[model samples]
Target: KRVGEDLNRHVTTDGSKAEWDAQDVGLMNQVNFDESTMPIPLCSCTGVPRQCYKWGNGGWQSSCCTTTLSLYPLPQMPNKRHARMGGRKMSGSVFTRLLSRLAADGHDLSIPLDLKNYWAKHGTNRYITIK
Candidate 1:
């Protein structure tokens, strides 16, 4: 029940734009190491060194080492289509989360740092906006 044909897609970073396959094809696993368990970027979450919790009013709170279910959507189904869409989005988000962490950590040392040196870099830049 897959829809249209897959097309080559790419997002320009820095200044260069290269073609990339739309499908993941298990690339994340190939690139991931033993320390790549964390999925979420910010806000306390499991797989990382932070703990999070959901509040009664509808917000996330940090605990110590608890697995917080904040903002995580339960599996919903009206039909197969909805489920497929949800799964696709979730997987896509996870892939993005991994890429972001890798990029931030400068683990893929092939690309040169644009604005600052990777050796002296630490922590997330809150003001940095990605196109």
Candidate 2:
């Protein structure tokens, strides 16, 4: 009865209850599911996907990881001194020198390649110091 009352209260552009009722029916029909798709087979033990099997006190047990439908908010980390230093601008020569030092310490050369490409295109007028 409450649902019917709420539906009747929903006003449309035609300002008629009959038009709103028809529109609601049309919208609901458009959201109908396809008959061709097959449903996923659920694990008999946990009712979720069976990822692994483990031996318990009796015999082999089916282990499954269940997913939550609720949304969980993550806590933010405090900004550190290194993050603040990352915003400092440096000359192209100084940037190249730092890259060379990193390379000598057995670091990956992809960082230098990316910096070289950026320096060639932008000419390093405002290059941020990459930590």
Q: List the candidates' TM-scores in order.
A: 0.20, 0.19
Query: Model 1, range 26-100, lDDT digits (tens) per residue?
Result: 544444322245432233223333323332232222332112132333233345433311111113333343454
Model 1 ranges off by over 4 Å: 1-32, 35-71, 80-85, 88-131
Best by TM-score: 1
CA RMSD for every model?
A: 16.0, 27.8
Model 2, range 81-129, lDDT digits (tens) per residue? 3221111122433334434444455755442122211121211122121
lDDT of 2: 0.28
lDDT of 1 at 39: 32
Error of 2 at 77 (Å): 28
lDDT score, candidate 1, position 130: 12
Residue 44 CA error for candidate 2 (Å)?
46
Candidate number achieving the greatest lDDT relative to the actual structure? 1
Model 1 clashes, total count: 0
Clashes (N, CA, C under 3 Å) per candidate: 0, 0
